[model samples]
Target: MRIVHDWLGPIELPEAPERIVSLAPNATDTLFALGLGQRLVGRSAFCYRPAGVLGLPVVSSYTRVRWELLASLRPDLVLVSTGVQRDLLQALFERGFPVYPLPLPQSPYGIMENVALLGALLGVSEAATRLAQGLAERYARLYRALPLRRVYLEFDLGGPITVGRGSYVDEALRHLGLQNIFSQHPQSYFVPQLAEVPKRGPDLFIYEPKPHRSRPREKVEQLMAERGWRLPLVVTGGDELAHYGPLFFGYLERLVEQIRGVLD
Candidate 1:
């Protein structure tokens, strides 16, 4: 058994958890990346990634937990992410369940650290260490070769919302040598009007479509046309850019390629 600190507090876990439940998408991805998918008996509805995990039983989401369903699963280790899950974590603890709440990572290095911490809890510290190190090295190289460009990244076209500082997306953009036009915003994300976007004079426009939702390039073009902003637009892999996970390094590489192509 081992004891580690989580966002909620200190918790004890078995040397190797056999039946695990992940409430956050990123945690579920980390379990699979650490080769512990077989042990993940329950996951949230939104934890679909790395494929083959869609069949798992759904127990909870970041903001909600099905107490009865979660209890029935009898998970030895229940993973939670900080933020809206705070109440869920407390409920599980009072119910005598071993729930581990992971802190929300706002930056790239914080994400890597969370991966390593998860690995330690899962008894695969070495694998997690290697994963973090490899990604750091790749990101370092990309940073050195990254192009200089001011970019406007939109996660939701309906509101034309964008990420700012304190978001992993912001860190990723900075790491790739791209400047986020909304980085100076006080909040992590905010909406900008169509007419307001052109005033910033961004060199590129990056749009990340929502999962299972189709927002084709033509739609993006239409949006730009409506706004009268003729900047080059690139649509990134929705889940890849939205998710902060072990595969994010791969996503980062792909993002760098896309940026290079756009800037060239």
Candidate 2:
């Protein structure tokens, strides 16, 4: 029922990993997308999608994982995305745990590749491939349907952080012919200054506003409401903006319409 082979080399793993612990939200989402939600025994606190997974045993957060709790769960396979829980991963390994650390999916294809990796882990290769194909088709449609917009997308505004041109999110934006203003920012984590935002006045300031609270630019939004700044936007962030994993396609469609509203 399950196959354990690497994309390039030989790597042996169980046919169907009975107990899986996902330490990253995106990673957990990928597993769910592969239809292996039933196998998840441990999940990150940040993994909120697929609805019911919130009730799963919580072992990690964005910043840390409770190693004691994770170890007690005795998961057969541990999957983590890079950057978030490296320390916990080290502990897991030292304690003789089998863990798979996935590098950040830096590109659109890379994300799909990770999907394939997830499929293999879940022993649901066919299902995973189908999901990946759906995403590819959505991307192709978006790429052909629209023209590039002078758009600004931020992963978070608390720090005024944004994605660069070639980042995964930016690559996704490219599908809708959307260009990120931060694409102009230096590679890696680029933090934009509020002062820098107005001079060029990106056509749309698609910010990810925290649902209940205003972001770091709250005062600026107020000032702009009084019409101090020239840029206007339909933006997202916080819980709502986090529609990255499977909901990425949704984020793109909303972005396309918002950009259209600005252009029209």
Candidate 3:
């Protein structure tokens, strides 16, 4: 079948890809959600969701791939993501690997579109459509018309990182009736000026602590105090927000509850 991908342009794919390798965590989750887990011959080390992907051979990371191991997998199709993986995608394509690059989503709706895209690529468009519709319905139910408030949301990615206009987090905040202070910025993710945060006059501060680097609420509060941030705060697990998969809606539910607890 022939389809036009945003990044890869027009491409041809087999009717049924028997063996697949997913190099991105989001793609891995989508593939499994589409009930195509059995066809996944390999996955990145970061693809730990659904618990079943763990057994697959780890052939890549976010920015690098083990060429020898990947070659051994003999995958009929290789799924990748844009952003940090752009270089990896170029390399794979030049090597004549059947690689497809999925764009990093700009919002929650983009995630659902990716589900549909993957389903179409794998010859399961009907299932993909159903999954996408279900997600949209679920999102509608989760939507709340809360009092709008300005928020400064930051992620601890070893260092401070925040989302801007073209990011899923920014859109997610809008869905919750919260305005991201950095939403006016053009870039998706970037290092924010610490001094400018307070000047933005956000009503609340949301921090997603780096994964696997657990800090107690008290410690987090202490750190914020050190920075002179006295605004209401909400701490997230850093997993679900960072991952734009089908499970992101679950995270959004938890996030809404947290925000309401703090604001209301």
Candidate 4:
């Protein structure tokens, strides 16, 4: 039986989640958040949560997990996540496989909802609730009192393109009280023409510098310096953005706090 707590919302557990296979990175992280790793039988090549599962079998990539291979694994519960092999999930169901497609949450509340749902699915609802509450408290403490500002999001180094307005990062930014500079872009992820860059005039630029490519974050930083008043939000020296691990909240808080401090 599931009971909704005053602070943690609905919490419940499954009988036993044995032989589980997670196809999404975030979902993999969520599984770890619930402390249910003993059942994880398969994961994507990108699953980096817990750091110990790096040696596990790689069933697929961003959106390509081999169904025949997956079927071979014979997972009692196969987990799918947002934006990863969405269409392939339909084909899996066509094969009479009971697949669980986790819905994408747009806010921290939604993340919590997923946590509760995961707890119920994994037979550790109570533990999931406790974990969610802790993360929620941390999120609130880090973001609630900070001064909000207009923000721009960028990932690729050479390309100053920001994410789509309806992206997970954008959701995180909104919670931090920042406006997405790409909100007006017709194509969610588009390269702003030089004309548009000056017109939009974002307060910060967030880009992933090419650290592996032997490029420094300074050249681009200097190019966009603009007297240090209207610089873009750049995140240097971090590979966490490449994967959605359990500690991703730390990454979000790290970037948000830097921006908040600068804007202060």
Candidate 5:
């Protein structure tokens, strides 16, 4: 089937991709959620979700690929996401590989749309639609009655990274009736000024510690204390906010509960 992807342009995809290779964590998670995990032959080293995908051959990483191993896998379709993987997609396309690039979602709705788009590409439109609808329903049921509070959210991607406008994290926070202190920033992700954080007068601090490089609550408190900030803190310990997958909604639900506890 021929489809014009926003990033990949006009391309022909198989009616049903039997042997698939997903190089992005989100795509890998989506494929499994759609019940197409058996079709995957290769995955990136970072696609460690559902625990079962770890059994697949790791033919790629975030920015590098094992050409020989990928060639040996002989995937009929290769799934990748935009942003960091844009150059990888071009390289695969030029090498005559059937590569599809999923755009980086700007909002929660964009994530749901990608689920539907991926389903259509693999001839599972019905299942994809149902999944998207279910995700929407779940999002709607999230607690939004908490009193509005100014929030400062940071991610530890080796350093202090924060979300702003046009990011799914920012949108999700707003959906929960919390105002992001950096919501007016034009960029999606950027290094936040530590001085500005205290000046923002946030009622709560949501810190997503780097995955695998775990930082305990006491350590987080010490770090914040050094900055002379003693705001209520919620340390998210995993890649739930950093990852754009179906599991993200579940994490958001948990976050709402956490925030309620912190505020109350």
Candidate 6:
């Protein structure tokens, strides 16, 4: 058995885990990127990456876990995310399950650390090192080329949900030379007073609508009308903005391209 330390403390793996269960979509994507898909025996409902994971046994969700089904699968290791899955992590740990919890990365460097950490845990450190190095180089290039702009980012339906300081999205925005209007807030993600938008006066606004859900254009319009603002607005897929997997690098690239198109 190998003992490893994670966000939830140290857990002992009986062996180099062959049958893995990923409870975080970002972890699932990272596993697949490391060519460890064959080791995954179970995935959470949200871990739908790598195309064929839909056939895997669904053992977890945001708030609930199928303990009976998960135990039946006999997973050697279970990867979980912090914040959203905090309660699940506690339950799994208390139940004597081999669980590894990782917090969502908050910066470009943190993302690379996550890739390297998973690589070390799974005995693929060499490959993970190469991947992290390559992604870091890509991030540097994007940051160097990015033009600074004052921006307001919108998530959720019609409300003023925004990325605050210390969030990964905030870091991503920093890399793009875009300043989040709510960056002054100490909280990571928060709902701000509506009056703050006009007082700050951002040059641009970006809206992210949830994936696979009907576009809530009316909500956006309603927000605009209520605020009486006519700033340049852009829409992006919510999943791409929120997910922290290495695959999200592609989404970040696209986001930069879109920003260049709109601002330049």
lDDT of each: 0.80, 0.68, 0.87, 0.66, 0.89, 0.82
RMSD of each: 2.2, 3.8, 1.7, 5.9, 1.4, 2.0
TM-score of each: 0.90, 0.83, 0.94, 0.77, 0.96, 0.92
Tell me how candidate 5 scores on lDDT. Answer: 0.89
Write the residue-wise lDDT of candidate 4 on 188-226 in tens digits: 446655455556667666666543545556655665675
* Candidate 3 structure quality by residue, lDDT tens digits, 106-161: 99999999999888888899999999999999888766555789999888777789
Can you write out model 5's per-residue Cα lDDT over 129-212, one digit (the tens) per residue?
A: 999999999998864756789999988778899999999999889888999999999999999999998888899999888666
Candidate 6: segments with Cα more than 4 A from true spot: 2-9, 157-160, 216-222
* Candidate 5 lDDT trough over 10 residues, lowest sum: 210-219
What order do you get sorting by TM-score, best first? 5, 3, 6, 1, 2, 4
Candidate 5, residue 222: how far the Cα is off, in Å: 2.3
Clashing pairs in 1: none
Alpha-carbon shift of residue 10 in model 1 (angstroms): 4.0
